[model samples]
Target: MEQDLLPKLKETSVLIMDNATFHKGKRLQELIRCAGHYIVWLPKYSPDLNPIEKMWSRVKMIRNKFRVKDIDKLFKDYCNDLFGI
Candidate 1:
């Protein structure tokens, strides 16, 4: 993933990352600095502040509504419902 992202550094600007310990690695920090972008870290223990969490909750609700036999179909249905919500 890092290799894939390295080439896009020129086009990248600010990086928004959650308060995850793994994302705070030295190598990651170096990479972010080398890309010449500011790293905006979100507050810890604040899922309500993250818009993606809302979409995920909606997806879960939609997935539970249907009796999907295949994992791929369930994922597709969840994404569709999320977008609809």
Candidate 2:
């Protein structure tokens, strides 16, 4: 999933993430670090402070609209469209 995002990132970016176990994997950390983007872990229970939360809402709405069987691909494509990635 992080691999898909690499193409969308700017030379310098700050990736704000929640404290999900999958989000903190060593491989993903290394990927972001190598890409020269820093990670900022958002505090628990502060979805209001995160722009991705809003993005997720938008994505979910689109997902529900399409009723896709392959949600992962749909999400990536939808995000790419939404953000012009």
Candidate 3:
């Protein structure tokens, strides 16, 4: 995130993220602050406020619908089918 996403963002941006352990790291927070952006963590257990959760739910739903035996193969197929990867 520091190497990629942080550099692409405009200055003084507000980053809204969930309370993931990795996101709470001192280094990550310092990096964000140093980059002239702010981090706002979503409330615990508030998946509804996190838009990515809905996308994850959709991905899981699609994966379950396929029910393939091989996970690696299923992931490849899932990406191809969904994203034309």
Candidate 4:
């Protein structure tokens, strides 16, 4: 993730994520700092600060509209329903 985002990040860029165990390491910190970016970890128990949480809520509501269990069919259905294709 760091490798891909590093080239695209410029000065004053910030990356945001929750304080999960997988998000930390000395190497990762060095890499981010070298790229002139910053990390802003979300506060504990603050779901409102996470925008992706709201997107997931909308996705779960859409999931209820589909009954198909087949992965391939579900992929096509999801694209069609979401994109009107």
Candidate 5:
């Protein structure tokens, strides 16, 4: 999975990733080094400081209104709800 993600990420200038075990792997390190892109990792156990975490929390609250059957609708409505229409 990381290998597949590497090519797309290479062209990007900056990426923020949470401090997780899987992302901390040596293969990922090599990928980053080869890509020559600056990577910033958030501190571990600090979801409160991450904006995406707050957004997801809001989505879960609003998602109770609708039955989710697939990824596309769920993501779309969740984003709309979070942004308040």
Candidate 6:
């Protein structure tokens, strides 16, 4: 985030993120604040409020259907199929 996303921000912004353990780190919060942005944690267990949750659910379903063994390849293929990336 610091190396890529943060430096591209054109102005101060509010970052809404899920309550992932890594996201709550003191150093991460400090880095965001130091960049003149604010952090807002999503409510716990509120999957409907997080758009990524829907995508993750779909990914999980697809993985189960395909019985994928290689996650890195699955993710790459899925992204390429879904977003032409």
At residue 33, candidate 6 shows an lDDT of: 98
RMSD, one per candidate, in order: 3.3, 5.5, 3.1, 3.2, 3.3, 2.3
Tens-place lDDT per residue, model 6, 1-47, is 99998999989999999999999899999999999999999999999
Segments in model 3 whose C-alpha atoms lie over 4 Å from true places:
67-85
- Lowest summed lDDT window (length 10), candidate 4: 55-64
Error of 1 at 27 (Å): 2.2
Clashing residue pairs in candidate 4 (N, C-alpha, C atoms within 3 angstroms): none
Backbone-clash count (model 5): 0
Local distance difference test, each candidate = 0.78, 0.83, 0.87, 0.76, 0.75, 0.89
Q: In candidate 1, what are the lDDT values of residues 1-85, reduced to their tens digit?
A: 2688666777667877877788889889888777776788889989887788887787677677997878798888886775752
Q: What TM-score does structure 5 among the candidates reach?
A: 0.63
Error of 2 at 12 (Å): 1.0
Q: How close is candidate 2 to the true structure, as a TM-score?
A: 0.56
Query: Looking at candidate 3, what is the lDDT of residue 40?
Result: 91
What RMSD value applies to candidate 2? Answer: 5.5
Per-residue lDDT of model 2, residues 1-85, tens digit only: 5658877876799888898899989999998888899999998889898877898888788788777779787877797778877
lDDT accuracy of residue 47 in candidate 2? 82
Inter-residue clash pairs, candidate 5: none
RMSD (CA, Å), candidate 1 to true, equals 3.3
TM-score for each of the candidates: 0.63, 0.56, 0.75, 0.64, 0.63, 0.82
Model 6 stretches astray by more than 4 angstroms: 79-85
Deviation from native of the Cα of residue 50 in model 2, angstroms: 2.4
Model 4, 3-44: lDDT tens digits are 587887666788897776777877887788777888888998
Specify the highest-TM-score model's number: 6
The whole-model C-alpha lDDT of candidate 3 against the native structure comes to: 0.87
